[model samples]
Target: MLDWLRVVRMADMEAVRWALVGMSLDTVERAPVGVRAAQLWVSRMLQVGLIDRARPAFRQGSVVWPKDTTSGRVPDLFRQTARHDLAVSAVSARYLARGYEWRRDRRPITRRDHQADGVAILGGQAELVEVELTPKTPIRYKAIHSNHGERLTREGYTRVVYLATPGACRLAMKEADRWLFRDVRPRVVAAPVMDARGAWSGEPDAPWAENLMPPAPPDDAGTPALWEGIA
Candidate 1:
């Protein structure tokens, strides 16, 4: 919890709920007690001063880093892109539950360009994660893809994951095929961001999890045909 707060810097209760649900499954029904438990812990943290809280820009309350650190307020991270960052944090939490390493995009100030939301290491494969809440024009997408491809090649990332609505995901996959090189193109897979109503809730809609691990074989199965009759 401390690590997640440090990485995300500023996130509210709804985003916390999203993370809890994501860790259990893609549904809101699972792991609800966790959110309440987390809320209690957060309230206690407030008293202890291990973290600080600020009035939200979009959501209700969020904890931030101390004044000395960069990006010290909830409103600061959400001043312009509340929904986007919330989604990214929720996704990052889910990735954390899956034991993936997380790094928020803190591109240097000298380089001002479009940057991905975060990077995640899944099953030893580094992934560049982009959370798209809304679709953009093809010209804009072209530039974004170009940037992503350059980063993928330069930074040793294996795949570019586009998390968006189903339609947007399809567009991402199409653009990936159309734009990125054939060698790395196959690695791109679009996973729709599940339950993104208010807080940008995140859940792995099968394809993303399948990329990391295959399902186990059936239990207590019969012997193979070659050995079945021999016994």
Candidate 2:
């Protein structure tokens, strides 16, 4: 009955957990384990009845999930957009690269809040990561910023990080400016541009400067160290 459990490798288990939060085949393929290996693991999981796939409303590819997990009254991974799928994958890759472990809880911080796209833990720090692919209305963004800013601090998170495309980053920054008093302004980093192998195509040691607040000082001598330590 549990034969699928036996064939499951660490990577397979990780993939299933990620599916609980919704992931695309492309995202699963980008795991630290090489693409071919990840593909094999996902296929095996499907065969064993540990996971299922569904075509999201507007996406070209299907999203995956565990057989039947629920968050509140809703299915855990339902109707995600293509942009959301890519964002989740991109954020996951960055955290995985930084040696952070994915958290398993799928619940929201409070009944009034929504689940973050994903959470990563390293040492004593927990980071709530969000991928903003599209801009939310100004009112909606403010509500989100206010809710998360308060809850995250109260929950003892080290910081929140938002990995976003260039356009979305600008919108987030504008909202952040309004909520600066809440101190929930997340460290914003440009989502890494990756190739098919999941390897980043840009300069490895380049500082993450997109949407950086209080912009870096003009002179090299005075510029605050700008890298977010993500390598």
Could you say which candidate leads in lDDT?
Answer: 1
Q: What C-alpha RMSD separates each model from the true structure? A: 9.8, 9.0
Candidate 2 lDDT, 1-231, residue by residue in tens: 122222221122333333332323243222244445555666786798676655545433444445643432323343445345444654454454444555533676566676666667767666666666666788877777776666565766655555554455566666766874533443322343333322234332334522221222212222123323333
Candidate 1 per-residue lDDT, tens place, 1-231, comes to 666666765566655654544445443342333666767766777777666666655555663433333544334654566556666776676666555667876584344356677888655667778777677787777877877777666766776666676556667766776887765665555655543433443344443454432211222122222111211
TM-score of 2: 0.57
Model 1: residues with Cα > 4 Å off, grouped in runs: 17-33, 52-78, 106-113, 122-124, 194-208, 212-231
Candidate 2, residue 118: lDDT: 67
Q: List the lowest-lDDT window of 10 residues for candidate 1.
A: 222-231
lDDT of each: 0.59, 0.48
